[model samples]
Target: MKKVSLFVKAMGLGLLASASAFAQYNPKASYEGPAKMNTWSVSIHGGPTQFFGDLREYDFYPVGNTNSDSYSERGTWFVGAAVGKQLSHLFGLQLGANLGNLAGMKRRQYFSYFRSNYQQVDLTGSVNLKSLLFGPNKMKHWKIDGYTGIGVLRFKSTAYQLGSGRVQRFTKHNAGDGTVTPAGYEADWVIPIGAAIHYEISPRFDIGLDFRINHVNTERLDATIGGDNSSVYDQVGSRGSFDNTLARKGSSSLDKYGYGSFMVTYKLGKNAIRVKKENGKYEYDTTKGTYHLRWTDPRNLIKPPVILTLEQIDSVAKANRPKDIDPRLLLDSDNDGVSDYFDRQPNTPAGSIVSGAGEAIDFDKYVSAALPGIACAEIFANVQFDTDKNIIKPQYYEMLNKVVELLNKTQCRLQLSGHADRRASDRYNIALSRRRVEAVRNYLVKAGLNDANRIVIDAFGSFKPIGDTSRNGLQKNRRVELRLVP
Candidate 1:
């Protein structure tokens, strides 16, 4: 038992050591149906086998005497194959068949030896212990499974006297009920229980090591009964019944045998090579290739829900919020070509042609109307509109009236330049600005201006902002700037 415990621990460590070297990338989470994955597989294994029954002398080490006088074969070999299917990440089933030989000898107790050739078939269910203990995310390519199931075994055995090398045949019943007849081949039920560790080498292949112990329903597997325990060497010659009736009379415990084998498995399905990116993420295409069910869990492919704290939400909102318009795009308080940010002459006249540096050019030539064909500095107050509205507001009616009075009184011609806030699309805002310019031009003509042709209109949409574009400052941008031009 101690040796068996140590072997189990070693297998577990091997699984963990290999699994720690790899990691699978988890995809973004959503509530999607499970994906199709490769599930069917085939495995083949073979290894040394040992028998434990009435004819055995030791628990682990076998007696290996092959002398002609006392011929003994204590260890043999077994070969097996299985077809399996994974129903889920945690559970699967396998149908398997094994053919092997069992041998045991006892020189001290009864001076007898037996060898049996057997075949067994079983259907077993496997539980993935690693996935059960750690959620599917851990152990990317390693699997540890515990399996158990029932089978039927058939074996033909012959017991022999050690020195004489003669077959031991039954004559008299141990209980003295009746004469006993020797049976050639025996059939019994068997339960196999074991565990294995498998490592996935790729999408299509896996390799593993497993140890299974089979418990048989009868004690005559070695063709011997417990009644032959007497130290007297002549006792075997007196009563030599190997029949079921004689075997049952001296039955103490069921027979058992165990084998440790190396396994190779091949999975069947359409699987593509898994590629991992430099970012430690797997690149997978569901349309072309599938993940294997033995190593994949549907839940691990899903991304977890996104959760945000109050501070994080606030931070995100602040980062994406529109910033106040640049002061250069907003404020040119003197309507000069240069913005106030770079303007050395911030107070240049509205109608004056200024230098690139905003310094007035030929100021004296403009103030006295001394230059021929030189127009006077234009003047008018701006007309405001409501948000997204093109209608001229009532408060701006008086302002438009005064502009009309001046246009009729002087030779000054009115220039209507309309604008809109940045809240709407550029195309829509341009149309809105045109309508506002036309509204102002119509108002000036209706307000008793003599020549309607004296007014010229231009629309500058949200492209030009003379004020803040923030929520509280958007209103200042929704207006028409009026200037009398040449």
Candidate 2:
């Protein structure tokens, strides 16, 4: 019981240590499905075996003197083969069969030597150490396991006289019954418990060492059950006139045998190789000849909105800004209070009462011109046009009315200057500009101006631009200006 307690404690400690190591290495790990093959293995083992039974001495020495021999003489050889299936990383099952010979000698009162040939079959459950402790990745080259199982053992034993080398066969039948019965050799239940360590030398091959102890339920494995002296002496007679006593001198404990073996195993199924992918998924790469787990987009995982710092915002704002700008041109290019867009007289003098066109007021010129009956001041607006267009817009009707009123009141001739944007060739622009002048002149003549000849037309291509040739500048250039001719 004490030994059993110690063994249990040791197994418990080993399990606890394995669990601790597993937790440390694979904190968030989970079991992946088995690879693309069935997990099965076949193994063969052979090694030394030792037996402990009633016919053996208690001391651990190995000498046979018909008086003081040891149990070490019971050591023999065993060979076996097994097939196993791995159910998971932590557990597996095995079914195996073993054949071996067991022998023992005792010389206390009468010398007796017993030899047995046995065949056993077992089914076992195993705990995989590498998988349980540090996962399959750590099990690449080495593995360890503990196993236990129950099986049936069949054996045949013979008792031999030492000096005469005479053998006596034990009968399995009870002749007291009237009916003749044949007892097949001894058959008993056995429990096999053991541990093994293995090294994988190749993808399909492994070498290992196994240590196992088989405990039998019956004490008659040596052919001596109870300590009945007359029953045994009658069977072999007196050896050299000495009484041959086959009585059991050892304790009434059941028999137990153990084996220490070297084993070789071959995996019988396809290898399950895992391939890793870049996006958290699994796929097989033919070029690399391996399977891998791939990473995937994290759409399933929660993400927070990004919050930018003030410095980052500032950097983005300034990235597209120009390094320098002409302040004078941006504000008032001609030193006029009005900006360039509204400044019709972009070169206005520093101090002058200017109209909204940014031109200096000329009351004397207006009064003088009016006194001569020429209403030149009435030409206050220019007729604008769409790009490359000659037709007059409806909104310009009122402005044209003012021009007609001034022309009717004045005796002076009016001059129309037409211009175009710099979009086409010079000849094309000059033609477009002349058509604009003709359009304005024809409109005025149709609006009841008696002397159509009083209006003179002139055209200028984009060579005479009033501003930079930007979109707004082009629109400004595509116009017809009205001015009184002196």
Against the reference, the lDDT scores of all candidates come to: 0.70, 0.63
Global Cα RMSD, each model: 14.8, 21.5
User: RMSD in angstroms, candidate 2?
Assistant: 21.5
lDDT of 2 by residue, 1-486 (tens): 433453465456445544543442333542233223345778999998777765575545544344333333635799999998754455567899999988776655445666778899998877776655565544345678877767899876665554554554342533445432322366777877889998766656779999998877666566555354544453453332212222222345667778899999877744323334358653433333222111111121224478889998899889977878554345444433345766778776543334456676653344334643643433323566898799999977765664565567677577788888888999999999999999989888888786787887889877666545687666767777666544
Best-fitting candidate, scored by TM-score? 1
**Clashing pairs counted in every model:** 3, 21
Stretches of candidate 1 off by over 4 Å are 1-33, 68-75, 169-183, 227-240, 243-249, 272-288, 305-486
Q: Estimated TM-score per prediction?
A: 0.53, 0.46
- Which structure among the candidates has the greatest lDDT? 1
Question: For model 1, what is the alpha-carbon lDDT of residue 9?
Answer: 55
lDDT of 1 by residue, 1-486 (tens): 433453355446434433431222222321123566777899999999988877777777787777754555645899999999876666677999999988887676567777788899988777778887886666677899887777888787777777766667422223345544354456777778799999988777899999988877667787766555453464554333543453432534667889999999998887544323446765445666787777777555556678999999999999999977776654776654457876778887544445456666653333334333344454434666889898887876765675565556556766778899988899999999999998888888788878888778888898887667675457767878776665
